[model samples]
Target: MSNKSSLNLEAINDFIVNWLKSYAENAKVKGFVVGISGGIDSALTSTLCAQTGFPTLCVEMPIHQAESHVNRANEHIDQLKARFSNVFNERVDLTPVFEMFKNQVSTSDNEAVLNLTLANTRARLRMTTLYYLGGLHGFLVVGTGNKIEDFGVGFYTKYGDGGVDISPIADLMKSEVRQLAAYLQVPDSILKAKPTDGLFGDDRSDEDQLGASYDELEWAMLEVEKGKKPEDFEGRKAEVLKIYKRLNSSNQHKMQAIPVCLLPDKLKLL
Candidate 1:
């Protein structure tokens, strides 16, 4: 929770730009590969990548994407391309790929699980495509996740949206991301648009799925970080704490590295 008085947009931008430059130099990658879903997070990230004077490949991989979502993504990419010489935009429709995948693993009498599986598959497919492009051109995949999604509640799918070589905005909360987006002159329509993962065909918003707005979730997470209990909320204690706990517990795995088993010399002695 960065205070307004302490938040310096220019400094943040400068730092991220330098970070990207240094990271690419160290990795020996040519540029950044990003999946642009028209969300402000992607918009801000790609914009920052472009500012590094390195190629920023913005791929719009629409698998049953809503028309509005596609339009917004194109609009943002157009803005980026117009402003930056290093910006590149491409569209790859993955509908057939998804349908083929859905047909392969789907079983009868589990429509709900199958539906969720399909959504996650969409994310992984996009990830695969981004990595393919990244490998082809020696670019690192630049993730579009923010603090609340990547760390707070872990809203991203593991090895799906969670798979990336670098995460520039993963520490900025959703509200702070909106502030940065506004400062970066992101289009007003995208800045005000409801946040969605754009994975579902019906286009459910992130808040609709999370059971609470990002502002509420961010505040609750901060309170929990400050050693405040649910009882501190008084009126909304039960409601707020429930959402916070459910999200953190369920999505914890996404935030953690993969677990590995280890054997010790003491075990050999035994």
Candidate 2:
């Protein structure tokens, strides 16, 4: 990381906004669909999309028992629409879907994997709506993972919050995102709010799930990104190893090439 006081933020924002617009044009999408949660990541993503001048459709997909989150989501959607030319809010209640899954699965709250699965289900449901409506509106889904979350440990729901066509900010660290947000003049409230994904209730934050701050994670991720050996980060060695194992094991497919079974019938190749 460079000196915090002398970062070139304007160039970062310009690069992201330009790349976003070019990605939309190349993909033949009319716009981009972003799930705005009134949080910094979504707000920054929405602002970048709007800066591109292409249509950005914001959706609020709330499951049951999340009134507070629903209200916050609506607030951001309204604000986003006011400044953007083609911003609209679409609602798709996922209570029934969640209920169906809960009834069918034998999940216990004491089990971490079970709890994670439930949260991931919600993420996937929201992603499904975004992609569906994206197809209908001739747009693509915009993801909100930063570099720390996108790489290193992959702190995202595999194939769930991962339905993105073009990632404009995946290479950015959280600190870098803050700088870019400042350059874009994003609201102070969003910039200062604690980071969260709103997967369960308004109270659920990413820090709570990770047991550490984004800044701490960013250091470890940056080390890994720079090709540091797993054993080198002494104090963070075990912690980073745990995260690397989970992400690599769980998202094996995301990192691997598509498999094609080799057989006698398919042996002939040019």
| Clash counts for all predictions | 0, 0
lDDT of 1 by residue, 1-270 (tens): 233335799999999999999999998889998999988999999999999999999999999999988888999999999999899988989999988887787465788887787789899999999999999999999998998888888898889989999999988988888888899999987998999988878869998888888888888788888888776666665577678878898988888878878788799894
C-alpha lDDT (0 to 100) for residue 213 of candidate 1: 84
Off by over 4 Å in 1: 1-6, 266-270
Best by TM-score: 1
Off by over 4 Å in 2: 1-5, 65-68, 104-110, 225-253, 258-270
> What does each candidate score in C-alpha RMSD?
1.9, 3.4
Best by lDDT: 1
How do all models score by TM-score? 0.95, 0.83
lDDT of 2 at 173: 78
lDDT of 2 by residue, 1-270 (tens): 231446677777788889988887887778988877667777788888888888888877777645555565676677777777677777777788888978987867687777677888888888888899998998889998887777655777777877677677888878878888777766766777778777765477788877666776666555665776556656665575456556546766764567997778557754
lDDT of the candidates, in the order given: 0.88, 0.74
Residue 136 of model 1 has an lDDT of: 93
